[model samples]
Target: MTCVRPRRAARRTSRSANDSTALQALARAGYVASGVLHLLLGWLAVRLAFGSSGGNADQQGALRELADAPGGALLLWLTAVGFAGLALWQLTEAVAGVPGTDKAKQVGARAKAAAKAVLYGVLAGTAVRVATGSSGGGSEEGLTADLMRAPAGRWLVAVVGLVIVGVGVFHVVKGWRKSFRDDLRATGGGGVGQAVVRLGQVGYMAKGIALGVLGGLFVAAAVTADPEKAGGLDDALRTIREQPFGVVLLVATGLGIAAYGVYSFARARYARL
Candidate 1:
């Protein structure tokens, strides 16, 4: 009886250790993949905002060419898969309770659920719409122009900006209140890597605020979108330049976004798992 009890205890300990290792690996992999995806998307956004493409035929051609890349498609799919996996892992961790910390698991689970709910809701809605064949299905050309020309287009943009700002603030508060700070302070942590993590959080919050501001401006400018002005990069740049102190703010925001992308890319390349 004594011998059997000892063997059972050993088996349980080994199993627990293996589970911990697996969960940590999954979490790290998720972090790296998500960071890379964000960096890629951020770079694309900043480029489109500042580039000379201006929504012309040439620009459209370039975009199509890039979109055709197999690597880009793979990355897109991988990111979606990674996000789903991460969300599931988080939920599991929360339910089973993460080793070494219960609070961390709870906070992570809540965030994961929120993120999954939003992403899944949108994706599911899109899938339903496509399956139902609701649209007449024409080329999406001029959609941007049409929207920008709408009476409340600028206002719509501003509302989106405010929403982004709200999200950023939420993240900032969550990070400060959660176990992230303690995680950052652990022995294997700190130094440039920790700084980078902090920077990513800061950048995320900044991005939300920037988006809110940009959306508001666009909404305000809906009335002024000249037929010649259109909804191209040229018009966007021109509008920014014409607004009172808008250009400086826009430029700074653009750089902030670029920095976030660079940081994410660096994290993907060098971070553990």
Candidate 2:
């Protein structure tokens, strides 16, 4: 009884510490960092539309752009800290239950949070690597290639593609239904709030479209027994560039992504801790 009590007390202490003000602040700042990265990627996508891209239209490309900016090194360090904080918060959420939710819903939500924690942790690691002069070599193409060489690699790649497609669809639905509101505090209805909602809807849908296309590429790669077909955001953007009215579609998608970035800044302020 005494040992069990102490262990329970330790868990409570850890949970309490996880909700610290500074950690929440850093987690919120992580949203801003995400916004910056999205904005840069959108800009790169727009540049692609004009046939004058200076870099890849993806997260790593965004990181490279950030590193080249004034005081970028310090900014990258801060972003790394912020992303780590966000990852920690997600991990905490995955471990702890939110009040009032049903058990099944809570389980599903926690699982999703756990997935987000992994993604945020990976982003944090990438930022740290870039800040320390590491190129952080590893592309989706290379990953697909490695998987191809392994047993049941093609099936694994197809599954990954399907998972990405599912995620993209989920994002689109979340934005369309404004389900993200559940994650925020009481944000009153007003011009600004409506604007944020609109921006989010556009942003999520655009991002979904891009991800959907990218995932399709992977699926195609697996079905055709070719690894060269799989690539990242840049490749996806290039694919969009080859379609009819491609310029217009690409520009609109880029603007939507930038809008999403702006919405993320608002989310940082209104999101529930």
Candidate 3:
């Protein structure tokens, strides 16, 4: 009887240890997956922006290019895998309620909600555009033109653009105050200092500013009833193409976006669940 009791106790202890180990492994996997998703999304953004479509036309061109480019294909695959991993991680985290997780969970939920809203909005807009028989196919200007041709469409487009820009600005600001400092500290590797960090922060702000400007221009153009005045990155590119430094600007912007992808990769790899 004494021997049997001792064996039973040992088995219970081992089972507890196994359970704990499994829980930890699950957590680690979850965090890694989230990071990977972020990286893939970032890559997708870059591919769409810089492909032959001039990163301006949000159409099937980018997807086709991604399918063709070996590197882009790999990134796309990775992105999908990463998204799955992130979803799993977020689900686990939500269930476990990890420490200091409330804010992250809330933010994540909001992001998902916002993304769904955008998706629905885009679909609805596309339907309207198709139904109305607008001329502009995929170009930002074309989208604006299509919308503007309708009686109340211009205001709607402006509102959507403004809302998008506002959301982007919020991400930039929140990301800077919370995640930016930590990311800089992690990536600085001695070469980065306070000034460098500040510059990076400014760069994030600049990105937000660019988005905001693009949004405002979209709104203004709509209000003026002139889609030609709707200036976006595509317009910027077109304007630059006529200038002496066109190639230089194009290359610079392309490289900058690529660098951003790398940054996103790093962020995903190191993010704690």
lDDT of 2 at 94: 73
Task: Name the TM-score of candidate 3.
Answer: 0.50
TM-score of each: 0.49, 0.93, 0.50
After aligning candidate 2 to the native by TM-score, how far in Å is the CA of 27 from where it should be?
A: 0.9
Per-residue alpha-carbon lDDT of candidate 3 for residues 121-205, written as tens digits (9 for 90 to 100): 3433432343334433466678788887788888888886788579659656843774465533255456544444444454455
- On lDDT, the leading prediction is 2
Question: Which candidate, 1 or 2, would have the higher TM-score against the true structure?
Answer: 2
If ranked by TM-score, best first, what sequence of candidates would result?
A: 2, 3, 1
Please report how far candidate 3 places residue 210 from its true position, in Å.
Answer: 3.8
| Backbone clash count for every predicted candidate, in the order shown | 7, 0, 2
Q: Which stretches of candidate 1 lie over 4 Å from their true place?
A: 1-26, 51-70, 93-113, 116-164, 171-191, 194-198, 214-247, 262-273
User: Which candidate do you rate higher for lDDT, 2 or 3?
Assistant: 2
Q: lDDT for model 3, please.
A: 0.48
Candidate 1 lDDT by residue in tens digits, 40-92: 33444445445444332212222233345676545434444554444545544
- Quantify all predictions' global Cα lDDT against the true fold: 0.46, 0.85, 0.48
